[model samples]
Each structure stands twice: as C-alpha cells, then as structure tokens.
Target chain A: MNKLVNQINDLLLQSIPSSPLETNLEESMRYSLEAGGKRIRPVLLIETLKMLSKSDNYEKGIQTALALEMVHTYSLIHDDLPAMDNDDYRRGKLTNHKVYGEWKALLAGDALLTKAFHLISTDGSIDAQTRIKLVELLSDASGHLGMIGGQTLDMESENQNISLETLQHIHKEKTGALLTFAIMAAVTIVQPSDDVSELLEDYSQHLGLIFQIKDDLLDVYGDEDKLGKPVGSDEKNHKNTYVTLLGQDKTEQKLDYHVKQAEKCLEKLREASYDTSQLEYLTQLFYQRDH
Target chain B: MNKLVNQINDLLLQSIPSSPLETNLEESMRYSLEAGGKRIRPVLLIETLKMLSKSDNYEKGIQTALALEMVHTYSLIHDDLPAMDNDDYRRGKLTNHKVYGEWKALLAGDALLTKAFHLISTDGSIDAQTRIKLVELLSDASGHLGMIGGQTLDMESENQNISLETLQHIHKEKTGALLTFAIMAAVTIVQPSDDVSELLEDYSQHLGLIFQIKDDLLDVYGDEDKLGKPVGSDEKNHKNTYVTLLGQDKTEQKLDYHVKQAEKCLEKLREASYDTSQLEYLTQLFYQRDH
Candidate 1:
C-alpha cells in the first residue's frame, strides 16, 4: 500500500505542467503536493477500490484521487498564505506564497482547485455518469458549505477563544468533510455493500477526528525534524487546539479513544467480509503521524 | 424576459449573505456579484429555456445561470486585482481587493468560484446527472485550458503585437467559452434537436466574438458615466485590443460582419422552426451596446 502510495505521488507530481505563464505556480502547487506527507486520501481511495475487487475502476479512481489530493493541496496553500495562517514554512520548506509571491500562489491554488474537477470530468476512464457523480461529490467537498465554510470559521476564530463544540464543528467541516468524502466517494464509485459503506463512513469519521486530535498533540510534543515543522508552533501562534483546551494528557486520551473507535469500526467490517486491515493500518498511521 | 432577468438578479443578491468574515471577504464578493450588469448570461439562459418551453427545467436553469454569473463575476474580480489588470475601480466602485485587502479579495474570488458548482449540485431542481454536466461545463470554462489560459495569453500580450488568429483563440477561450457553455448547456438540458443546438453554437460563438470586438471599441470610445469606467482605459494600460491590432476602421467592419453572421445563423434556426428571435435580439443588443 505504501509503495502504491509513492507511485501515485509520483504520478501526481508529474501531472502539473511547467510553462512560462505557469510562473512558479506549478512549483507552488507541487511543493506542498509533493511534500512528504502520507498520501492517505488517494491511497485509501485506491485501496478501497482494490478491496472491493473493482480494480477496473482504478484508472478513474487514480484521477479522482489526484483531484482530491489537489483540492487538499490547494487548501493548504491558501491556508498557509500570509493573510491566512501567516506560516513561513510547511513540511520543512518555505510556504508556497512565501516563495512564489502571493499573486502566483493565489492563481496556483485557484488553478489546482479547478483542475481537480477538470481532470475528473475529462478523464475518459470513468463512465460519464460516474464522472458526473465524482464532480458532484468533489464540488460539495470544496464549496462554501464544506471545507471553505470551515475555513471561514477557522479564520473567524483567530485570536478569540472558541468553545470546544465550536472547535469540533469547525474541524468537522474543515478536516472531517474531505476525509469523509475520500472514503465515501471511493466506496460509492467502487460499489460496496451497504454494510461495508456504512462501516467506511464510521471508520473515516472516527479516524478523521483522531487525526485532528493527534495533529493538535503533535504540534506541542513532536520533534521539529520528524514533524517537518517547529514544535509548539501552534502555541506560538496562540491558536486554539485540542491541547490548548483539553490539556496534553486529556488530548492524548481523546486521540486514543477515537483511534480505538476507528479500529473497532474496522473490526466490524472485517467480519462482514471486507479486507480492512489496510484501513486499520491507515488509522493507526494517522494517529501516530507528527505533521 | 426582462422581468425574469431582474428577478434573477434580485434573487442572486438575496441568496448571497452579506456578513463580516476575517475581513471584508463577503463584501468584496457581494460587491462584484451585486454590481449592476445586464445579467446577460442569465437572460440568455432563461430565454433559451423559454424557447424550449422547458419551464420545469427553469428552476435548475436559473441556479445554473446564477452560478455562471458567479463564475463570470469572479473572473472580473481576479482580473481587476493588482497583479492582473490593476484596476482600482469597476462598475463605479472599488475593485474587490481594493475595498477589501488582497487576501480577502483573493479568497472572495475563490469562494465565489467554488460556490458556483456547489449551487448546481445542491439544487434539488436539477437531477444529479444534469448537475454533473453543468459542473463539467463550468469547470472546463474556468480551468487553465479555458479562461485561465486566455488570461495568461492576455497578460503575455500586454504592450506586444498580437495576431488576429491569436486574438481569436484568446477571446474564444476567455470570453466565448462561457458564452458557448451558456447556450450549449441549455440546449443539452432541453434536449433540443441537433440542428438547432449546432445553430445556437454558431450563433453564440459569432455573437461572443462580436461582443469582444465591441468591448474593445467601447474601451476606446465609450462614455465613462455610461460604461461605468473610464474610456481608453485599455489603451492607457498599453493593452492590446482588436482596435489596436486591426485598426479601428477594420475592427468596426469585423464587428459588423460577425454580428450579421450571428443574425444570419439565427435566421436559419428560425427557418428550422426554432423560433429563436430572442437570441437574435440578444446578438443585436450586444453589437449595439455603447458600453
């Protein structure tokens, strides 16, 4: 699975074109896209398809996966902009807009967002109806009431003390929406059983929340070299986090509980005749990641 | 038809929430969205549906039309940013980023762009299948191969000589793609006869080209009070225009030829029992507009 993940990452890197007018926009998009995070979204998509024995869908799945990753990458680019998070570094490299200038960075993000759908729509591997469904799913995940709305909330909460429920709501939309979309879309395209599909959603939401909590914990405790960013950076910004609200010990406990719930959800699927050990591995991996 | 146009314009303004965000992002978006244009795209779409008597489809068509306008408005917003055309004012008000900061302006453009397909997908009036097609059309029109590509060329041609062939390619993608999508999508949804659809395409393309040329002429000879911006703004920016490339006299002649060709195509459609006199009226309206 990891090997296939690397292969998909390579294909994604090769997908963006370099041209004069591209103006480092490609570099900006590629920098974060190729930044060494786990390609979990696309990998899960492919794995879900493979597990369903619908491997013939892999071609469209790959393109859809790439589109999903592009949307995620574009969000990160804009999120790291000076106006947004003001982060100078991400994944041990200068942030995109910092390196590429704001204008090209903006276009780079915009280009990536649009290209995601364009790739899915134009890619001939998917059936026309399936392609359309993919577009609908993607647009929902990317639009105002999804990730962007969460971003609006995240931005709106800057320098203010937001309640834990508010934080959860924000994260649910911000991170959970895309994470849920990744697994659910793959399942939908792969045509899984209802039981399997329900388990996928359950497992994904659990893992998604665990991922965010662990992300919060890692910001306070992880090594800079291993995390690819400075420790306590979130604290330095005085931003809200699970650690800030729940304390490090409680945050750790909450993350553990979510991971366990995610694993247990997978266990139910294991008995229902799907090969879900890879999902278990993925859930564990998300819980353990630093950056 | 005019009443429907006004209703759409009003509904569009009411549909968009005017609220404070991290900055004036919402305001910047609303500024361009609410700016009084002719609602030409929406009018064309509604009229197209009216001709087809697909009033049952009007609900989706109206939303799609609004989405189209949003895409169009976002283009204008980004085009007016400092890194693009650098215009301080548009439609007699500060450009998006001018009233809001650059960051908000960029995000507002993004929000509007992403919301377009969101509107289409979530609208219950349209089947998910048709929503998908609309997404494909809008995404292709907005992507790097379309409007963005044209924008790159336009920026590249600043203060440089551009051939008529190159100009056509740029305008076709930049301006004509959305216009073509407008008519094509309606016909596709209405399931019109192939001959009628093809005629509409020809009519739209020719009229779109004429519209571009008239815009060039207007920039050089329009009234500021009427045009909502200073005349000769294009020349002042050292931007290439049809008038500059073909000379004013020839450009005017070209515009007349295309407008007549557009009308002629519409005449064929009428003879085919399409009763598309509204489209003919739209073509003449664009050709005759001073601004």
Candidate 2:
C-alpha cells in the first residue's frame, strides 16, 4: 500500500506540467494536489483493477486513478473556499484559497476538474469506448445529480435538525458517489462478470458508508494532530453528521455493521475464486483509520 | 440564426432533468443556463458543422452545441462569483451567486462544467472515436492551458499597464480558446480534410480576436441597455482592455484587421468549394455586435 501511494504521488506531480503561459494557475493546482492525502480513492481503483484481473499490471488503470485523485483534490479546494466551508487548514497546510487568494484558488480548482477529463480522454493506452464510458460514469458520479447535489443538501442542512435518512443521503451522494466511481471505474476497465461486478459495487457502497461514518467519528474523538484539523468542527458548524444523528455509540455500531457487510461482500467475491486480499485490507484501513 | 437560437434554448431547458435528490442544485444550474445570452458559441459550432458538412441535418451537432453552451455558461457563473468579478448582474438579471447564494452557484457552475463532458461522452450519434476526440479537444481548449489560464492572467493584470502582446495573449486564452473550440468541434465531427481544418482553425482564431476586441469596444461606447449592464465598468475595474491599451481608433482598426483576416479564411474555404456564407455572416455579427 505504501508503495502504491508513492507511485500515485509521483504520477500526480507529473500530471500538470508548468505552463509557459504567464499565470500561477498551474502552481495553485499543483499546490493542493501535492498537499498529501491518503490517496485512498486512487488506491482503491488500482487495487480493485489488480484484484479483479488477477494481475499486478495495473498500468492501464493509472490514468483513471490519477483522474479520480484530481477530482477529489479539486472538490477539497472548492469546499475550503470562504464562500463554501471557509476552511483555512486542510491536512495541516494552508488551504488553496488561503495561499493563492480566493479567485486564483477558485480558478485552480476549475482547471484541475477540467484537467481530470482531459487526462482520461488523452490516455492513449485506453481504447476510445472505455475512455468514453469512464467520462460518462465520472460526470454522472461527480456532477449535479451526485457529489454536487449532496454538497447542496449538506450546506442547506447545516444548523437544522436533520433526520438520519437525510444524513445518509447526503453522505451517499457527497462522498459515496466518488468512492463508488473509484471501484466501478476499475470494474469498467476489467469487464468483470456481472455477478462479480454487482458484488464489488455492493462492497464499495458499504465501504463508502464506513468511510464517512468513520470521518464523523474521527471529528468527535480522533486526535487533531493526526487528523490535521481541529476536532468537533461538525458540532461547531452545527452540521448534522452521522455522529450527530446517531450518538457516538450508535455511530460505532453503524460503522461496525458496514464493516461486516463489506466483509460479507468480499466473502462472496472470494467464493467466486477471485483474490480479495487487497480489497480486504482496504476495508480494514477504512474501518480503523485514525484520520 | 433565430431558429437555431430557439432550438438551443429548448434543449438547454431539457438538458438537466430534476433530480430525485433533496436539493435545489438542478434548479440553480438551470437558472443561469436559462438566463438568455446570444448563444453565440453553440451557434458557431452548429453553423460551422453545417457549412463544412453541407448537411442541414445538424441533429448530430445539437448535443455538442448544447455542451459548448454549458461550458460558456459555467464560466460566466464562476467568473461572476463574489471572489472573482463580484458582479451583481449579468444579462440584465442577477448573477448566479446573487440568485442562488455563493456556494450553490459555485456548485452549479461545477456541475455544469462536468455535465459538458458527460453530454459529449454520451452522444451516441457520434462514433466512440469522435466523441473521445471532442472530449480531448474541449478539455484542452477550456482547461488550464486555455480558458482558465487566460482568466488567471486577466485577473493578475488588473490595474496594471500591460503590453499589447500580453493583453492579446490574455484574451486569446480567456475568451478565444473556447471560441476556437466552438468551430473546431464541428470540424472534428465532420472529419474535414487537413487543409480545410487548418483554414477553419485560422478563421476561428481571427473570429475569437474579433469577439474580444468588439467586447472591449462595446464596454466603452455601446449602449448600456443593449449590453444589459453599465458601460465603462471595465475602466472602473481598471482592466487593461484593447480600448485602454490601443485607444478607440487603433482598437477599432485591430478589430477590422481580424474581421478581414477571418473573411480571408472563409474566402479560401469558398475557393475550396465549401459554403462560406454562414461563416461570413458570423464574422460580421462578431464584428458589429453592440453587446
């Protein structure tokens, strides 16, 4: 996993070359991308590809993985803008808007998002049909009906007493859509059997829930040093999170339930004669991460 | 042209379906899109396709045309954000941020941008290869090296004395790249010969310059009512426009030069046995528009 993370990091650095144009837009884009995260989405994409194909040659999936990371990073940059979440620090560094000023940061995020599709479209290794399919899936997952919709709901739900169902719906679109895209992109690449694909999708959904529930859990109880931001921001913002909807104990139970469900999906995949070890490890990482 | 505009308007209305999600994101996206503009970009695309292909069955180009309009509309929304131009009005109506609030407007722009690629990728009437090529071209034209890069330079050059070369470069990227994309996308769809494609590319660049130079001129001397905003706001913002750098007479000369150049390209296309009347009309429209 560490090796895969290093590989993803190296590729990201090379993703956006310094433009000869007289603008710091590229710099602003590179700044947020280089501010390291766990690379969880990309890693999941590559690992899913490798596990399903029974081959370590995951080279074909690299562009899609990088595209996924770019989308995630762009969202973070936009989310931290003053008009949005107004966050100053993310992952222990000044947010893109903090360092680049609001306007440039905003353009940088736009550029990064645009570049994600460009990367996939220009990946010469992939056939045109697959690339088109990836673009379709990605836009569906990240556009108005998916991540943006979830974000809209999340923003409106702030300071309001929201139901647990509403909270789940928000997370499902806001974050889960992208995570599911990560796994499904791999599935799209490998063309796995319908049963395997269905099982993998179910597993990804559970994983997305576990990931968000853990995020809510961490904000309340995890170490701020590890998380790289202050804890209890959810409460401070009056945001309704899983932890707020369901108390700490209940959140933990919910997290455990997802973890078990994820494992069950993996169990089905394993019985189908596919190696699920890498994905199993990923489930555990999402389940147990401190940040 | 009026007929084409109406067709584009009706399709834009149908482009974003109401999502089942509990959010007003689709409404926000549709608001700015439905807000009337000249629909110049998409019209250029469709007209270019018809001229090059000599086929009035432009149904093949409708989706791409709508996609082009979405990209244009998204840029306007983001450009009008409080963190950017901070504009209160566009097209005589409240800017997107003013209508939907800042965050939702931002997300709406993001969603519109993403949907552009989705529309192209899912365009089943076009071949997979053609769709992929369009995606590649659109992203390059609209991404970091193109539109976004131009915007960054424009923002940085505010209140500063900039060279003609620098100013032209800024407009070329900021406004010109996507305009070029408008024409070039049609060439891609029609699969024109190399010579014709080259000529069209030159024509589009000159057309782009004409568009921007006329924009500068309009901001200085045009009717505020026709423009749907106050004139001379560019000067108030301390922008280094063509009118500012070259003065009114020389700026008009520059616009005339590009108009002649664009006509020359169309003339060559005419000699090469392609109908150039539509393109000539577009060139005149760009050159003489009051707004």
Displacement of the residue B288 alpha carbon in candidate 2, Å = 1.4
What candidate 2 gets wrong by more than 4 Å, as runs, is none
Error of model 1, residue A224, in angstroms: 1.1
DockQ for each of the predicted structures, in order?
0.41, 0.90
Model 1 C-alpha lDDT per residue in residues A1-291, reported as the tens digit of each score: 767888878988888877434335566667777874777788877777776663434765788889889999888888887667778887777878778776566677787898887778777776766776677777777766667767777777768998998888778878988888888778767777788878888888887799889888888888878877778877777778999999988888888888888888877877877777677778878977766
Candidate 1: the clashing residue pairs are: none
Off by over 4 Å in 1: A13-36, A52-57, A86-89, A98-101, A123-129, B14-31, B52-57, B98-100, B123-129
The sequence of per-residue lDDT tens digits that candidate 2 reaches over residues A1-291 is 899999999899898998978677888899999996899999999999999989999988999999999999999999999999899988789999999999999999999999999999999878999999999999999988889889888999999998988888999999999999999999999998999999989999999999999999999999988887889989999999888888999999999999999999999999999899999999999999998
lDDT of 1 at B283: 84
lDDT of 1 at B112: 86
Question: Residue pairs in steric clash, candidate 2?
Answer: none
